[model samples]
Target: MAVYTHLGSERLAELIASYDVGELVSAKGIAEGISNSNWLIETTGRDGTGARYVLTMYERRIDVTDLPFFLGLLDHLAAEGCAVPATIHDRDGAACREVEGKAVALIEFLPGVSPSEPSPAQAHSAGRALARVHLAGTRYPHTRQNPLTAENSAGILARFSESRLAGIDPDLPATAARASDIARQMLGGLPESIIHSDLFPDNVLMLGDEVSGLIDFYFAANGAMAYDLAVTHAAWAFDPRGETIDAAVGRALVAGYESVRPLSAEERAALPLLAQAGCLRFVASRTEDWFDTPGDALVRRKDPMEFARRLEFYRDAGQGAFA
Candidate 1:
């Protein structure tokens, strides 16, 4: 979440007034992610209690028409007892409101802290939570395609000149090309479901090895469940720079996920390639963000090479990475 649009105090108060949530006490901008403007909203509750909510202004990378699918998924997941926050509908029962012609949502503020360096037990809990999400979403009525696939990544990279890509790193273009080839050959017949394609550590809130909440479902989509596990494994089992893998953490995460939902033999066989796809997806987006993001944007620029190294690791380790 980032702040591209700055709504002043009066505008924020007016926006809060549209809902019965209560009078706005404060709105603080969140500056972690790349896609949207987010704020931590605090308010005086209707019951004289204090309440907090996360307000997200749809910025880039999200289409306005997809609001229902995104926000509704949150409500659906929450209803199914997944550790996900719900969308707070306005007095008119709308899940989102338009602010300056952009769609904005008020999400239920859940408790817990995002783990920085997660423990093995925390990784286990997060895995279990993700598995639960896949199982719960089986009956969800709507379906949306995964937008950030390996092919999509390759296409995005194709638009960039080789020189521009090389500017990030000399080997980036070759790495991305290799990724595209693997993507085309990604195994079929794998199980698919609603997936939180982006389950990085920052997206998970944990308290004492238990997953308290899973936030930021913007990248959530209908996709391969094993691929989602691969994404989580690639995300959680790496060092900050993505230079090394923690085998213990990797084992714990896969163990935790399988504890809730066992992987099919086909899914197990596909993991190494799926993990590579996960890395490629990040490499593509981060490469774009690296060159495209403005110098003064409130969002932080992530290194594309971090995932490049990860892709290399997955390629060399093969299925042993999962084992």
Candidate 2:
């Protein structure tokens, strides 16, 4: 069953009707996400025509104040011809509205399947898509200030006490120690930019072999561009077993990205360490969420070691592999 905050089917139906969209044909929860409640809503227009849209109800995980930046970013991207969800305005011409005490928005659905494991070509396409987004976002009104810092890394390691480390794995303390040192060393060197931040394979959609659309802008923020690349690389270039799937794939992705915007020498130099920091961030978050969050079984965290391996590959092979 899909989870919801407080809104019910009947109330959602009323909200749609108020907008004069159509009769509510169907409203059901979507189960793929762990952060928020999503519903596939079907409606009939005044001419008795069927239309489908996605209705999203904000979850407690994200601050509601951040919604404007996310929604506006999507609108700006869609205006630039990017294949992202189109925000459907209400009768009042507002893209978002308050319903059942929760913020809600209806968006035109894009047709595509989420890639479980993207191939080299797909990863390259995603890299190019990200470049396009960055180009389009240069003039966006909102700017994101990154909250991650050296102190955050130290805090994460401190939170994973020796007892907890022993409980999960005896080597966890050593792993955390090494990860913290790497994070601190790399902290001052990474390049910064507006980034999607979370571009896991599931956030990207595939139509046959090409990238059809990008979704879930909840984690979108201004951070390190190389970090974004590293996150996508960690997601697409490696497998669940923590092995590089295809070196050519990694090369192709970087090539595609450079086709749009050339990477600075500084950006290129920091890619390896930025990738490492990205891995460490996810590892720390997964460990914390795994132990601290309620309904742990409901959330599936990816293997932290997979990202760790990608970082190791970049460290050993250097940028020549990507070149």
Give the alpha carbon lDDT tens digit for every residue of 1-323 in model 2.
35577566688778887665788888878885656788888999657878888888887787888888888888988998777887888888888888767888887778888778677788778888888887777767797665554346557867777787556556456556767677667655444556787888788888976788889888788876777886677666766766655666677778778888778888888777777677677666666765775545764555545554565666677665465
Displacement of residue 268 (Cα, Å) in model 2 is 1.2
lDDT tens digits, residues 287-314, model 1? Answer: 8888888868866789888898889898
TM-scores for the candidates:
0.92, 0.89
C-alpha lDDT score of every prediction, in listed order: 0.89, 0.74
Clashes of each: 1, 0
Against the hidden true structure, what lDDT does model 1 obtain?
0.89
List ranges where model 1 is wrong by over 4 Å: 159-164, 293-300
What lDDT score is found at residue 182 in candidate 2? 78
Instruction: Name the top TM-score candidate.
Output: 1
